[model samples]
Target: MGTYDYIVVGAGSAGAVVAGRLSEDPGTTVLLVEAGGKGRDLNVKIPAAFAKQFKTGLDWEYYTEPEPHLDGRRIYHPRGKMLGGCSAQNAMIYIRGNRADYDAWAAGGATGWGYDDLLPLFKRAERNSRGGDALHGGEGPLFIEDPRSPHEVSERLVDAMVEIGLPRNPDFNGPTQEGAGLYQLTQRRGQRWTTSDGYLRPARKRANLTVLTGALVTRVVLEGDRAVGVELEQGGSRVVHRAGREVVLSAGAFGTPHLLMLSGIGPADHLREHGVGVVVDNPNVGAHLMDHPMYLLNAETTAARTLAEAESPRELVAYLTRRRGLLTSNVGEAGGFFHTTDGLAGPDMQFLAGPAYFWDHGFATHDKPAIAVGCSLVGPRSRGRVRLAGSDPSTKPSVRFDYFAEPADMTAMVTAVERARELLATSAMRGLVGSELHPGAAHTTRAELEAQIRAGVEHTYHPSCTARIGSESDGVVDPTLRVHGVQGLRVADASVFPTITRGNTHAPSVVVGEKAADLLRSGVVAGGRAGQVA
Candidate 1:
């Protein structure tokens, strides 16, 4: 057995930040344990090759056990099992969600998590290509850059939005998120930059930090109510390590909750059902599951100007030599947020445009001249749950995405799809596009669109809120993200978000980690004393 000041579970998106930050103080020792191997795959480094890494050894390809609400189909959830975790495999879109998302957290029991409080941390963690300011920070670890190549389709998409009266926003993470524009990716000089590359890589040189890859944690070793350490299976051998200070759970939305339940820190009846003695009876360990359900509208380009036409030897050469062309596009090249109606107070819909038919984001190869326009409803009113299947640590948790359970959610998605079709019908988009591939012009009725949406909508890859923060009687975590019934344990990921954000959740997840790191390093203190140097 070994000991360290901090034993961070899961070296994924958030864990990387915690391990990296805690190790910054040379006096403290940090141990980062990852179930997967080092994420050095070529696909991980290349900005556009992200799809190639899915379902591979580097991925923990989790699937929901046939969600009954969505035609009883199992949804594919490809989480990264590599060093950077999903940040290494994700589409690289950088979105911090709306300022209201944080403010809502403050209103809903998460004190010190308001927009004004978290903005500085967001700025501090980003090294945006656009440079530093009150809005964008440049000296931080994570790199955000413009795509190496911009497509004409993006221009057409933005033009259509402008025609519809939506402003063209140059930066979505800027002052407001109510416009259409090109998406800035998590890249550095045209290369994919993950949390591992940005945060952990630089911090690895610190003598106090020890990163252990291929170490699968089976349980959090608890001594009474305190999480003292972790038990991991490394090299086919079980080893235990004690934390001198704390065991930080930054294993992300899925992994952390699973680890918690496995270690007997979940619903009492469920733990008893699995024959595992309860440690904390935290009934909300995996409740309130949520995800962004998206409908993709495929259309053939009128002029073969899409990525489909550019995926040839010539384009490959251009990419290899100059880091230019379709290879650098994050697929979801340009998008925007807009209100469905004038009466709405905030944007309720988001469009994710791509110049290619990304059959499961290209997880499966196809030979269709397709480009996808994703229409998603922000702030879905529907909720779902994640539950343990059995007592075994290796068993995958059963996820019920319960998509479109609410009428408003379905209505919003249908309207968003109709809006996307209208945007495509505009003069600018008409000149750039061909015919609709999925729901053709014949399918125009609201019922038909709803059916099509129900049939075609899939996950937008943002699963969160399984371990939400709320008041004493309503939530699993408190204002500081600490588990309600458990001591010396906290969950810092999308799972802790009270409500799903209005955009891609990667940026917000990172922000949660940054904030959690501050809390952990400061002995898990809330506000006022937060952001102070150790």
Candidate 2:
């Protein structure tokens, strides 16, 4: 194959958007390489069946090192192993995160990445069903729709939140992210609208764009310090593909840093230990890994109001015919953001209320009707890192989340559990809800709650900030997303997040892609220098 203007590795959220937008000029050729096959699994389409894809071929099924804070349990971290990546596997919630998050990035020396600067890009990428506003876009490639059929229990949860003095926010992606309401989903007519669906699929018809699935990128082909191409394996054979202009890495937080390490770019001491040659020796390449630590507060219900009741032929028929029923639910049907205390810059805690028993990250489900509230400490103080398990690209990286390593994180989680219990105990849910399931009512003391948190806390499936954009002292990528001291190379993915956003990372990941495409199209190179397009 001939060299292309750009070689985008990993056809996930960011890679899809980058390739799609770069190829729009018709003159520029873009190649998107994906390690996984096309996401054509039947479970990928049904919103309610998302958990069914877990531990299967569609999931990478990465597990963490035993968390010292969580009773030495190795938590499962399931990433998508297909074209759309986690977007095809995740609960289709569309959350843009609090504006404060981006503003903080700018304050931390991400020059062009303030909340105001990225808001337009966010609007430009979304086609919200609620229509355009100063904050939302009406006609964009990615679709954001209201839940087709929210469950009664979900409605009651929102009502219960309102009853507890939290405002009823109709849209979490609006001006204020501090309230309770139904979650908007990345769906259209009840089907999932993944990045591959919104960006890559349409661009596939263009002759300038080439998509290669099952192509596992092994390392960046570097000349001195600049990335010129990539070494990859496809059809059990290895090949080197060159880039005329640049090579973009969108292989997600874990994969991107892992690949960089394999390509001899990472912490010098660690790479030396693994016998990998040093290229740039960026110390922060795999540091600052962050994720929302969550705990579930579940309760048995008096009536069969959960999704467990919707497993019959009638509900399936209703979904197939009109796209309305439990099948349309994203599992986390309703939720909101709330401050643990007053005067916080943003919501310290976020909730995702559902009608089903969500235990062990939805790997296990109760047979009877039950309602659960997922409370997450979104602003966790604890940080983690991803390291190369070995020099070989085939070996999975060692992921250590080190959750609750900070004492403040544990305090916030305890408060989160208490708040969720309060919501479930509201009068609106009195008649519907029964006894507490996981952390029983008997465990009321702060010490007991703290103990329960230690035993039961899990990840919210939002991993980010492994390779962030920031100042020269602390960041892996610059504000323009170009790797420090490396030319013809950039990263556009969740890994580049300056900080973990307040909500789901899917929307922000897409925003990164859109902005990266714009940066590349404008011929702006690293350090704000003008450059020629290939």
lDDT of 2: 0.88
Q: Give lDDT tens digits, candidate 2, residues 391-474.
A: 778899999999999998888888878888888889988898888888888999989999998898887888899889976568
- What TM-score should be assigned to candidate 2? 0.98
Per TM-score, the best of the predicted structures is 2
Worst 10 residues of 1 by lDDT: 525-534
| Candidate 1, 2-32: lDDT as tens digits | 8998888887678898888888899999899
**TM values, all candidates:** 0.96, 0.98
Write down the TM-score for model 1. 0.96
Give residue 281's error in model 1 in angstroms.
1.4
Off by over 4 Å in 1: 309-311, 341-345, 363-368, 524-534
Return the clash pairs for model 2, or none. none
